[model samples]
Target: MIHTNTAMKTQYHPISILFHWLVVVLLIAAFVVIELKGQFPKGSEARELTKTIHGFIGQIIFVIMVLRLFARILFGAPEPKNPSQALAMLSKVMHWLLYAILLIAPIFGILYFQYAGKEIHFFGFTWPQLVTPDPVMKKSVENIHELLGNSLYFLIGIHALAALWHHYFLKDDVLTRILPKMKGVRN
Candidate 1:
């Protein structure tokens, strides 16, 4: 059984909201840079530069995800405004899946670079090539990274749609929970 309560209004911590939107922006940048890289011919400097920028963005995302996880633990989220048991369960599963992908995808990207025996240059520093060059392993890890990267599109779309569904169809505060509060605006 479930009941909708319009009076219940709780929002996420301000810091949590910042981190959430920051990650979203970073993810968009990452995708854009990688896609833009394809416009440049292979082996061109512009292509490599975009790839490096994408890597830097990925690294930043990984660090923020770690912080976000800690913030989530320390400052737990508000309960959904009157969700059914099934909706609550589904929300939890979706969130955990998103967290797993955000955390693990970067590691796989790093491993791909390592397996390819390439140094990751970030802001004048270089990451050591931790793994010996193995063409076979490099290709395998690249495939995995690509698969995870592609899955993000589907997962993010569903997440966004679910939030919209809650906001418009269910008339719930689910979307506004993570949105920043504005003056003279009611969430």
Candidate 2:
């Protein structure tokens, strides 16, 4: 049997951690396809292929995010120990902003593609049309989606910097909270 206090101690659920890392992998793949997209000549097979892969991955990321959100709420997360009230509020705001971007960016991409008269298909699976083609709307949504996708690097960098700050300077569990546990070693 476990004591209530011991059980209450903060630790991320294993499944959540797994999903987190999985999302990281997907994010990397998404970035790779997008970054390499322009390398291929315009209207080339490689360019089209990369775009398809990127679209598929983007959609997958959104679906996984939905699952991650559900799991996060269901499993709960380690409560934070903020050094200051301001920092605590900042932390919450940053997190929600990241979540918002993850959810919104893909949606914008889907809408953009549909309006651009591009078929949104994953492998052989087809996504039904959402709206009639509109070059104006497509261009607008494409720009926003692309911008948001690129912004992930900056946002993720800030998140990592904060984790390092906590680990090296504040000497807190902020970073370790999401780190995998080691066997026969101090966690």
Candidate 3:
């Protein structure tokens, strides 16, 4: 007899949850790397290595984001059952902005790398160069990339705070909406 696999009823899609958490972890790691690399003196191989790792992981995030977008479009997601009108609108806007940034930031990063005369390695495969070396262009792209990073941090912070506010102060069903439901809990 063959056993069929069934999806979990209580949890979000395993892959979705995994990707969600992975993105968070990767973002934290990226921030830490960026901070450490900046604070330490430059011109060292360690700094260079850290930068390469950051770029590499960033590329991974780009790919993951693409897959996530596709998954979201194809599979769709359940929205919060009940939320204040303002909170609901904020959620929609924030999600769209998040997607916009996820899609654009990586392209800019890749462009920055190319303009800086660097080849991108994606999991042992090298992506062809997209731009000829130009320090000025590279500098411009780097500045934009940095700006996007800062904006993304603020957006993510707001998202996190909103969730916390719902759980703690608002005392609404907002947090429970997206979270995997507990088996024994009665609504």
Candidate 4:
């Protein structure tokens, strides 16, 4: 499937699809792990384990996002399946917002963790402290962090709905284009 020309891609670059699914799985894992934290006592080992895993996954997501951004810049995207300019513009805006959110959310987590005077460890590696402790700033950043993180539910829902509409209603190639092994639908 190697081609000399980038535009010859029938769908997204294979690497792009890989990054997309990896981030999706990681994001889901982070959300589920965070939700389960409440089941454990605040100071219990289980709670700490859950938080550690969630934060680690957040960092992983951030790394993957950086790579994904570079891939997008270097490889570019497959041509849009939608024909309407208005629809295309809307899609672009949604995607930009998604990227912005994804990039910012993890940064917020790291900053909040540091500001809260907690060690930010990911995997076996320790993250460098980026800010000094400040309770007021910590509270504010955590609130914004929580707000942006929660907003993902709505934003992702819209993205999924749009893809579904394109696939089932408009019967276009929008969804299939990003799917790793799915064949793009012919017009």
Write candidate 3's Cα lDDT for 1-187 as tens digits: 2112312233345556567667888888887887778865687888877878878778878888887776666555555423577766678788789878876887888888899888888878998986899999999998998899899999999988887887788786555655545589863
Every model's TM-score: 0.90, 0.90, 0.83, 0.88
- Model 1, C-alpha of 97: deviation from truth (Å): 0.6
Candidate 1 residue-wise lDDT, 1-187, digit = tens: 2223323427777878999999999999999998999899998999989977888899999999999988777677776543688888787788889999999999888888888777887678888777898889989998998898899999999999999999999987889889999999987
Clashes of each: 0, 0, 0, 0
Per residue, candidate 4 scores C-alpha lDDT tens digits across 77-180 of 76555669888888888888889999999989888889988898766778788799999999999898889889998999999999999899998788888887
In candidate 2 the C-alpha lDDT for residue 83 amounts to 89
lDDT of 1 at 42: 93
Model 3 weakest lDDT span, ten residues long: 1-10
Could you report the Cα RMSD, in angstroms, for every candidate shown? 4.8, 3.3, 5.2, 3.4
Pairs of colliding residues, candidate 4: none
The 10-residue segment of model 4 with minimum total lDDT is: 1-10
**Candidate 3: which pairs clash?**
none
Better of 1 and 3 by TM-score: 1
- Kindly state the number of residue pairs that clash in model 4: 0
The C-alpha local distance difference test score for the whole of candidate 2 amounts to: 0.83
Off by over 4 Å in 4: 1-10, 182-187
